[model samples]
Target chain A: MIRRLLLFSLLGACSLPAQFGLFLVQNGQDVASSDQTYGFGTKPVGAVVNLEFHLRNSGADAILTDLHLSSTDFQFIPSAPSLPQAVAAGTALDLMVQFRPGKAGAATADLIANGVKLGTFNGIGLASVTVSMGDGSPVPSPLEFGSVKRGESSARTIRISNGENSAVLVNVGTRDKTFQVKPGTSPIPIAAGETATIEIDFVPAADGPQQSALLIDQLVFPLVGTGLEPPFPPPTIDLDRADLASAQQGKLTVRLASPSQATGTGEVDMDIQPSDASANLDSGIQFLSTGTRTATFNVNQGDTVAHFGSDISATFQTGTTAGNIVFTVKLGYFTTTKTLRIAPAVVGLDSSKAQRTSAGLDLLLSAFDNTRSATSMTFTFFDQSGTKLPPGAITVDASAALGQFFTSSDLGGAFSLHAFFPVNGNPGQVDSVEVQIVNSAGTAQTARLPFTTP
Target chain B: MNRAAVFLLCVAPAVAASNFSSPLVGLTGDAQGKLHLVHGVAGSFVVRGAIAGQALDWAFAASGGLLKTADELRVLDAQGNVIGRRTASESQVLLNPRYAFFPETGELWPASAHRDRALLIQSAAVGGRVIALGPADQREIVLAACRGDHLWLLTFDITSGALKHESAPGGTIGEQACQAAHRAALLVLEDRVLLANAHEIVIQTSTGQERRLPIPRNHGTRIHRAGEDTVEIEMSGAPSFVLRFNSEGERLYELPAAEARP
Candidate 1:
């Protein structure tokens, strides 16, 4: 009899209706209380949607003990009353619910009070904006702009499409001054389903790779680019002749490995340093212009080589006294120089001494010439029979052989040229030798010297 | 003070007779006889002695003294002998209270105020390169820079690291302000900007009102702030002298170069 009594009480509790239920409220007026589900409508992601409702007590006086929301996207307005409040019968309490979707998709939640279902909420979220390359290609997270010349600009365009159902204002910008958004590309409202283009320019003020970001609303797109040094490299100056002669006109060829990509003017200066204090370099060196200590050469755009006089080679006359000329080519931050050792070109053979050994005849010759570099020295040998030998004449490249001797360390004028010659075969067979010396300017020959066997 | 009393008070120590007779050469031939400033001082002063055969473009009073040509910077001692030297290719020179600025390198020396050893103050903060710089006080410097079509006036506080910027449209006044002759002819106060040239001194207020004070026979002149509301105009001549004036354009007194301390 007791078990039957408990079962009756449980059945009576299960048959009772909920005391609190929620009713839709529109524009501060009661709309309906019978609908099971309420739609919050579509909203752009990151936007908020608020739905007003009234929590009405329809059964009897009850204490509202608890409230729960099923989804994190939904929340109760902080201005509402606390839980555990007593509600009189037939009375209604105002309540506000807000839904904020973080991503594009369908969102839903359930409203429950005191272990009883009040209502269900649903909404749709849409992406606010879409971004892509100007050519309709997906933009990489960090858009890379290869190598851009320093002090120059490279531009690219991107398309920003609005995916929202209503017009929305969008702002796009970069924090770095090197990366700039072209004018008239931002701060404009984009209509729904419409697209706009933004031209971004990367003008690196300095050299090296730089990283920055493009901010569109709350979204950040990374960007990267490298600035290359100016394309103009130091030029190379080559002299027509290795050894320049005093009081003589010579050619200097200015060559550049690459073409100039910059527009403007550049100059090449000739700095002269003469060992002789009385040497007047200003009056001697002349190219491009006359009677000037420093000669100027101009470089134009797209020119691989600079022209001074008539061609790539500039004609400059050396001073009467020997000296060193430094040709400096300057283009922006690049500077290159070529030094030419100028000396008198006179060549002479002073004396020749010969000795007989077991191997052959060794000859020591001494000569004095202002220009130490002699182009060639020829030795004509004759046997005791007075007939030319098998190897008629042995020629030596004096200039190449003496190149190592005359270096930047040499500072004296009218240097002496010393040379050794060894004649093979029987020393007794060698009788006489006539030597001829040749240089850039004048050539000199020596009288045939007689040799006697020991 | 009377001119005689001021001269007696500010008379410099006895210098070599050769110092006054030597000829002064400018960076350019045309710049000869023009007035220049010795920045890097507690306050600025005119260079009294001649710097002959140096072909110097500008000079500063720091680490004893420094003179710069187009390609070299030479440090001089109290006895006027070169003690240090370095290769420096600079286009413009800027002076502050304690530091001197050289071109090709945008940095302040003595390395006391900044880190990273570089400051873009020339371009980023001023909108262009600093053409002229003058001391406002012990820790403040007033500078001028030129941008696209505007001239900027910037004041920097050394201790607090605060910077104030003002700009005006470029036209006739802007061109005169940038000239090398008027490099030290700018004085910025709390409410007005003072710019001086050979013929007149222009006073421009923050409210955009402009006033002018004619300077008679003031061919080579430089303007400096003597106090909060007073300014001094130094005229270059046989004997350079400073003419003090109030903000109302009233002449206060004249202090000759011989009487100037720094």
Candidate 2:
């Protein structure tokens, strides 16, 4: 084993020639080994200085195999070629070394190639520019400005200090127009050991989350903020009439808090709940002119009220069953409610009156059903000879009477419904009229009333 | 295989390629009523035949003979060359009348602020919103929209700024058919209004006269107006075919020939 080790060492020594030597080039020319010291001059800490050295192989072909530096301050940049690179005789190999000193002082390192000392790398490191908050700590990467109202501005101050012996001129800027550097000069200079303030205003033009970044020389600091909507109070809901009765349909208006001051548009979801949970309120409360059980209303900017139906007021109906209905509306973070009480109905058809005019006949039917409980009302016209007329009979059901029925002045606790019939050719076609009212309770018929077409 | 099958195979790639995907983006027309069916993904768009005799390939999707991207809007001639461009606005520019869509606030404005400016139009309204603008006349502009389960038609008068609207029933013109056009479609010529759903086509007049025409089975999507009055309907399968109608709304031909007004 001792003989084998001696033979291997002799073979390694024989592979290298006596004429083989290495040299570094500066200013495009070769420098002798004793005069080769790469001086990086002065640079700020955390700043990198790259020095390219032309390595000339004067003798036979040789493999670089590996490269090492004595001090940790100097390193090879990522673009440098890999190890074990071959260099032919009379040909040159360009090698690069990066010096990034971490402290404010003189730094030196030796470059070793294939176990041979090639040259010394040296540089003077100075303090870099410092970016910080008002409390004198390093600035965080992403500075959050919380929520800023739309059409309003929120300002923040960032201090930039020059720690190097020389001054530093920085251009404080961001790509986003929402984040503006206000009342400050660009390319502001800070002298050594001195600080300069940059006031950045986050003026949100719209409502939503916003993101941007501050570009300070080669460094990047992120900025984040949210544009909030102005305080939009919940809409005020009101019914057209105070007395809400069963089977009665009316308009419901949802007015905005302040129409002129509105800045943004939004939607409000409506949910209707009856006092009796089992009772279906789907058909009871309709909105948006399409007759939907639940709907979302749009409140536009600078509008007097939210859109409900085809207009600003929605159409709501109380079905046959009388009770209280609670309307709950949700808008953004707010939830509000409005309750409507419906009165029950008393069913009756007391009397009827008929008259004739130049156009035709007008009939008035008096009933005690204030809630329009009668599901169907029919009218039959006859001639003076007691023969049924050619136009047959006409009927008015709950769908029609729900909106037309009104309180009667002739009878106490009664409502009246009016109907008109036209005689086209002859003025004396219809002479008498008979009326029939039907509901779930019972059916009632009124006697024929005499009528003359004048 | 067979002589007939070889002939169909040779002609298939001239109009459609298997690269076509759905749902369709938009269907627009030129001044002469030549229809352009826009489909496929965003960047790799496939516009099926706008200029006459041009091979159907992946190209820019058109809107009223105009092309738009995220930053610029270009006007393309019949030979598919850019004639004009409008890149100065912060809002999204749309052609035919040059409307601007602001992204910061969801609002639309006329580029020139014409007297017929539609201020009440919103990106989304209470019940429905304006989807597509159809052919305009001397005094009015027709808009097709989706309301609830059906399709609706709105006419905006230019001089008076009055808007009149009407809608068909739920099954007449379904919202799905309306939304697949990226919204809705209405072909107008003077007082005549023509619109179609998946099942049928409806023609209405200003005097309240309406007529319904049933579409043939196996027709997939319908695009109105190939010439002056033609309706081009596509049938998608292993081999797709385009069915078209005549001006009198009486004849049906395969592959080409289309016309219908209102």
Candidate 3:
């Protein structure tokens, strides 16, 4: 075993000269050791530093093959000779090595040939500018502003510091119109190791998600903000008049206007609450195209003010009694009540005394209510055959051949409204007359009178 | 004997609530012929009596159309009891019936002697169910039938029961893609037939012109007459919607199911 080991050691000594013939040279000087490291210290990020290395063959034989790079940060120049290259004895070949770091960090790689390491190259990447918040914390890559309402502004401060020894000219701007930088100037000069504060304001013009980037020289910091819609104000509803007659129809209008400066949209709920269960209230809203009796409506966006008009009609059962009925209109959280007076049926025609004039038959009417007020009294005349006379054939007079029958005091429910109606047909042909007395509340009562010409 | 009670039988109360899983069959009047009753399917049928009262359950399995004799509608129950009375002629009786339909071949048999003779068209043999039976005009009867996944619109002469017109049998009942057979319903209007599923409504006029109207999809849908020219659609599920449309398929109004109920 000892003799065999001495024989293998002598064989290795014979091959050492052939293996030691390959040498790496930098800048025309041969490197004494293959393990030596070369460093290009603290180069700016994205900066490429080029270096040349020479591979010289000092032995009489042996060629280099399978030459390739292992590091992504290191790239070989295309002008360099192809791999599997051969160098004659006492001859050299040149190759270029480039170090381009993508970010601020240390990069290291080894140059190898045929499974043997040749040399190590090291590099340190330096950032040109460091951006941070106003309070000195590192500025988040995406400066998020979260949600901001439309037509409202939100602001944040960005501190840009020059990390390089030399001063940097940073032209601060935004990629979208939604963001704006205060001071309205470009190319702000930041001293080395010194920071400059720039206020960034985000004012969204529309509702939805918004995105932009803050451009500081060649470095871009993303600006993200989401524009939200503002809360809508409740709708306002109003009635044209509070009090209405029982048989009269009235109008109720609903209006919606945004409290914010921007236009908005929403929906309004409208309904009627009647005070009396016996009162049948009929209401409807006139839509843009057709009228709907529904109590709900929608207001679309971009509508500055939306108006809806509703027609309300009330009806009461037949009775001689008078009372006030309250109708409430609710829109959103607001409510308004209107009181309507249902006038009593206090007027009646007297049938016993009837006189026939040369033109027509005459009839007398009287009011019975002492508390209910009215404005006018209308008398409808019908012939004895129960056929109503046309308006052109009959005439009513409160002061003809008598004092004022329906005076202001009578209208105020202080006295009875004594009125008379004359038929315009021939008295000889008119046998009897039917008179209908109608009050201002549209309540009416009728009586038939026997007619005799005197 | 009371004419007012008979008139009330023809005009029943609207369905305040419905369960789409169970079939609902409405009849014209009670056993005494006092008022109309809306019958819904339950373990025992729910009968809504008197047009405005609470729904009560009835045990008998009763279904049939009202028979018209001169000016009165006489509907008999399965036991030959006079349960329905209304003022309607032979033509008017076809417009809207209290019962679901005249089931000629199903287990439900008509008790009235005049019902079988007055039927304009017999039920189809292939498990066909009558969705609606109404008059297209004074002389013709329009029938809507559902057999499997298809809906058929058939018009027949009122007197002779001769088939006048028939629509092509297919997915013509507004069947949506991948929709099951149990989700569709049919409505017979004055001049058209409405075939509706969860997704759409297909309106086929008496003259064979077809129109399609899209609606929101739901689990189950039911279509019934709201007025002479209006039809009400009820969608069943959480947060259901009730939609009203005219005969021309124009949307009149839409309300949430909760809001639409009395």
lDDT of each: 0.56, 0.52, 0.47
lDDT value, residue B250 of candidate 2: 30
User: Per-residue lDDT of A301-355 in model 3, one digit per residue for the tens?
Assistant: 5543343322222111111124554444444444545444544544432113356
Kindly give the stretch of ten consecutive residues in candidate 3 chain A with the minimal lDDT sum.
Answer: A311-320
The better candidate by DockQ, 1 or 3, is: 3
Q: Which stretches of candidate 1 lie over 4 Å from their true place?
A: A1-127, A233-368, A371-454, B1-262
Candidate 1 lDDT, tens digit per residue, B66-174?
Answer: 4556676555442334566556566565543234465345454422333344343444566666655544444655666656534677776644435764666244456
Better of 1 and 2 by TM-score: 2
Instruction: List residue ranges in candidate 3 displaced over 4 A.
Output: A1-127, A134-147, A167-196, A202-228, A238-244, A247-251, A258-294, A306-443, A446-454, B1-262
Q: How does the DockQ of candidate 3 come out? A: 0.02
TM-score of chain B of each: 0.48, 0.45, 0.48
Candidate 3: tens digits of C-alpha lDDT, residues B1-262: 2322322232111011110011222332222322233221111112233442211111122223334455555554532245765443333222243332334432211223334444435544323555555444345656655565566666666556667786643445434311354333566665566767767777766576777777767776656453222354555542222233333344423321222222
Tens digit per residue, CA lDDT, model 1, A1-454: 7885565455434432387778888877766646678888777687898888888888776666667778877778865468556666798878889888755557888888867778888986655888899998988889887789977888878888988776767778887888898764656578888998888788887788988888776567888999876767567887888866553456677777778665444566666676555332133344423323344566666788876544566555453335677778676677888887865555543234455657555554434344544566676667678876645655655554344433321212222332333334345766776777776567777777677443
Docking class of 2: incorrect
User: How does residue A169 of candidate 3 score in lDDT?
Assistant: 65
TM-score of each prediction? 0.29, 0.35, 0.35
